[model samples]
Target: MNTSRILRTTNVVLLLMGYQRHWFEKTSHRFRLSLPSVVYIFVLGVVYTACFSQHFDKSSSTLKVLKDISPFLFGLIRVQLALGAKAFAYAIYSSVKSVGAINSLLKALPSRNSQFTQDEASAYLLLTSTFGILFCFAAYIAYEMKFELPPLPDAMLGMALLLPHFILAGSVRLYTVLSWLSRGQLKELKKNAEEELRANLTKDPGNIASAIFTVSTEGLENLKTKLEILEANFCIFAQSLKHSMLFLFAMHANCLLGGFYTLTYYWNTWYVLFEDRKRRIFYAANASIYAFIASDYICLMVVLFMMENERRNFIEAIDLLLAQRKLFSKKLRPIAKDLRGVLKKKCFKFGGPFQPNIIYVSLMVCLQIIIVTLIVTVHYLEDEISLLKEEFSSTDDN
Candidate 1:
């Protein structure tokens, strides 16, 4: 699947976009920060900050359909900007330190007996990344046309929107690739163990000692070592993105809330749309924007949950292997024990405090729905009270 080439290309795009300081050296293929790239990222952040101020200013005036929700929308925009900047900063600073770990994984992949088999994983990454970029550009043009902002500031703001998605896709792709590789290694180890057991059983069913003797302790130890290294690397990877992930988690919730609020507002004002054509267009555009952002958030969440399942499978596979060896002998017990210890360590988790699992994600979704309902109810009551007040004032005058 040309995994190395994919990594090389993606890494270069990230570097050029000012998301990362590190770049692969052309001849040596070593990962190190490029001086120019670092400078460019710094400047890019400064410029984005400046453009966002203008964007925020324009948003309040130009966006008039949901006046009450304007403040919340503005806050969402600010959070998006913050998420992007923080993600970029962490990618440049914390993640660059993991270059050595990344290099080790890269080196290990080529030496492995199995070839890359996950073309679907590669395609998923490429498609999501491409769509994210396209969405950002489309958003930039939409905002610039509607707000009549200058090209430079508009483009900068667009890139701000692009950064989080770009960083996230890259992070998930790397993690997925690692998880797949680890699973492949586990498969080979299991197969090796099974073959030894079968060969011994054929000679004599009661010769458990023969099976234990034939089992390569060295190979078991090596697999254990590899898993340990991968787990440590996962820790580093998680810690590196800790702060950034906090922002991203918040960003997702914020997006969902904002999208729901916008949609609900439009739903309530469905009749009002007939009075103003421009307002109708505005409502549709905002709905579409929120929908696009929300879909991306949801898709990413699902992918993470799927990855979580992959992690669970890894632990289960270890248990199955251990169970298979438990009856062998006292000698096999230590090997089983060591693998069990590896299972005890916490593997990589996404979204910082808000770990991606079915329960937590479902709870979060339910909570958002409840919050939106309360907001809509309160807003409706306020409108009814205002209408009653106007009628009472008119009655008194008559």
Candidate 2:
């Protein structure tokens, strides 16, 4: 409730928002490369070539190709649409970057007394634009579902499956910016308090106790307010991100196991079919793309987990500062006690059910590898048993 606290909060909010705006701007700039669109076009061309080069009769070839590769094609379309939404969001954010317009918009909001800085206004606008893009994309998918009979259901299902991931991505971005701002504010507050205490002690050494009490009390209050704000606004994002990470972890494991299963089951057939140069090229390209996607998902989850860990560490550092007895006077000790109580009661954490530290991350990686290895071993055993059965039957016939 202090004036300095309000100013600091506002400044941090604005800084966090500005970071989002700059991110969108950079993303928009990158979209100029049109890489996603090019990838989509390239994928489409590959499908077309693969479909036409088939030696089967036209009907059989068409059906066979569609059956075999429709999932990949649909995946490409979904990815392209998501990229298009990103580009659209970037455009919307870029068009509203004028300071006057942003300020006016913020002033028009119901919380006008909050005096949202221009940077905060820009950040809110960018967030709104992003949501707008997501809404439009969802609406378009629903609209297409009303008319398109074949791919509509599949497309809708895919969107539904990916919605959590999209939410996690947005939340991660917002939480990261907010975390950085919080850390910066904490550092600044500590530095300013130290300077104020030094000046007070120099002026009147006898009043050092009062200066310490005042600085410690104010710092505790500021830290509490910041944590409250973070908990209220950003914790949901962290929770959602945690859920998304777990989901991705499960997904990657499934992909690994499924890929091994498919390869084992179809190895002989694929070996014969892929003897053709074009078929081998197609298979390799498709496998590489799938591998890249899976790897990217894993990388994203790792980065998000690491960021969450850093945020938790920052909070712990503040807790450590409060625990320092030398920094507190007798009169200010109760305030520090209260701050510790608050922290104990409402500590911000990244994971639910399991703590997401380095050990957890390493465990997840090892679990996937172990599962994949076990699956491959089982598959090999099955193959050996089948070969042994064939040899026994031939011997009996002889």
Best lDDT goes to which candidate?
1
In candidate 1 the C-alpha lDDT for residue 284 amounts to 57
Over 1-398, each residue of candidate 1 has an lDDT whose tens digit, in order, gives 44455556657666654555777653454567678877877787676566556555555433343344456555666666776666656666645666666666554343322355575354346335545655665575466457555466556565566555555444444444444444444445446544433333323447666765665566566766766665576555555544554555556565566666666656676446544645554555555545554444465455556556555565565566556553545565576567656655655444345454456656766776687678757866777798899999999999
For this target, which candidate reaches the highest TM-score against the unseen true structure? 1
Which parts of model 1 are misplaced by more than 4 Å?
25-30, 55-123, 126-203, 210-215, 270-284, 287-329, 348-354
- Flag regions of model 2 displaced more than 4 Å: 1-216, 240-245, 263-269, 275-328, 331-347
Compose the digit string of candidate 2's lDDT tens values, residues 4-88.
Answer: 2332343334333322222112212111223443354345335433432332234444335544743433343444344433433
- Candidate 2: global Cα-lDDT? 0.43
The residue pairs found clashing in candidate 1 are none
| Candidate 2 TM-score to native | 0.48
Q: How many residue pairs in model 1 have overlapping backbones?
A: 0
Error of 2 at 26 (Å): 16
Angstrom error at residue 181, model 1: 5.5
